[model samples]
Target: MTDSGEKESAESMLAEIEKKITDAFEIFDHEANKTVDVREIGTIVRSLGCCPSEGELHDMLAEIEEEEPTGYIRFEKFLPMMTHVLMERRYKPSPEDQLLRAFEVLDQDKKGCLSQEEITKYMTEEGEPFTQEEMDEFLSAAVDPDRGVVLYKDYVSLMAIEET
Candidate 1:
């Protein structure tokens, strides 16, 4: 693409991202404050399919606050964070790293493996709750029956196989 063409594409992408951020803030800003709170930030990030660690979330909120020091995130502060996340997602980690990160989010107890109950609860909590059949199928495919838990390695391997 020519320089002008590239610039236009970049502008178009930015505009689309801005629209999406606006729509997301509207839905997740529970207090109608026109700013996104910390809790809302977590929900928004998860809804976007990224599982950031607690520390990472805190850092993101802090980074946003550095400019304005508001407890909540206005669009100007929110845009850069959203852009960073979008870039990270576009250049995703390896499948193993992705699975490990996901497992860390799901393993609420830090047990290094996910219990069936934990998986079910986490999946259900996401806006579109998983059905019993879907959960069962996932367990059958991802869980280790002997251990009765979903190990990170096993889950990663299962996903790798599925992609083939």
Candidate 2:
């Protein structure tokens, strides 16, 4: 193959690897949002990409922790690893259960569905508000007034679970 072809092959391989890593982390993040522990870190690491020992992950976390400016672990910093590790834990709630829980958390009303106004108000009151356009985009296709209310299952499945 020509030099350019070789370079393209390498780039393609890298892209594939990146996609795998991204998908793994995305799964992990979803599980972590539900809650997982530090002791289970090694398992999550293995599930995320390659298998690494618990001690290794612990050591890496220790180093990462020490180097942190705030002297504490931050969600943004360890999110990838943490999300991946926790995903391997078997106690994860089913998707349906997670959906129900999310609805319960966000619903704030016994109405059984979140309206655009409710979501917008919730985000605003929480301080990390979403823009009108962003909110619409996030809720689009997921919520349906025609259905009488946004189903909890649809809402959870529709929302992007990645670290934003």
Candidate 3:
């Protein structure tokens, strides 16, 4: 296929995945007695840059063995399911694990307390080739250090706070 054709194919797949995810979210929300408007679903799909079809979305949710008890979707279940859809094979760490991982990312120097510059630089490094604006928007302040940089202890503490 031509480069343009390949790009279009990829975009189409992404849209399909996003649609599936949104559909699953809607199904879960409906079961929860909540109404999921197209606007909200569209926002999620657009944010992720992908959409899944109805069948694919349900397949993704099948592992949970849940169906809308009230014949409608619930946000509670939908939220977790949506999270899974987005994360895919990425590790879903426990709270402690998440904190530790965040600490590892911020503590690039192996010394504690990540400086603002360190945090920014480390994030940029992780997402190589990302625009500055992308880095700014996605980088979490949870790892931002005070004074020199965030101490390892401080970074972990910040992560803990966010988890709670």
TM for every model, in the order presented, reads: 0.53, 0.38, 0.33
The candidate with the higher TM-score, 1 or 3, is 1
**Candidate 1 lDDT by residue in tens digits, 82-106:** 7778655632224666767877977
lDDT of each: 0.71, 0.55, 0.52
Candidate 3 structure, TM-score to reference: 0.33
Q: Which ranges of candidate 2 are over 4 A from the true structure? A: 1-15, 19-99, 145-148, 160-164
Candidate 3: tens digits of C-alpha lDDT, residues 27-86: 535445544543345344333433454345446445333354333333555556665555
The best candidate in terms of TM-score:
1
TM-score of 2: 0.38
The C-alpha RMSD in Å for every predicted model, in order, reads: 9.1, 13.3, 15.1
Which candidate do you rate higher for lDDT, 1 or 2? Answer: 1
On lDDT, the candidate that comes out on top is 1
Model 3 — which ten-residue stretch has the worst lDDT? 155-164
Task: Compose the digit string of candidate 2's lDDT tens values, residues 84-133.
Answer: 44444323334546657866988776777777667667756765555676
- Whose TM-score is higher: candidate 2's or candidate 3's? 2
The residue ranges of model 3 lying beyond 4 angstroms of the native Cα positions read 1-91, 94-109, 127-140, 143-148, 160-164
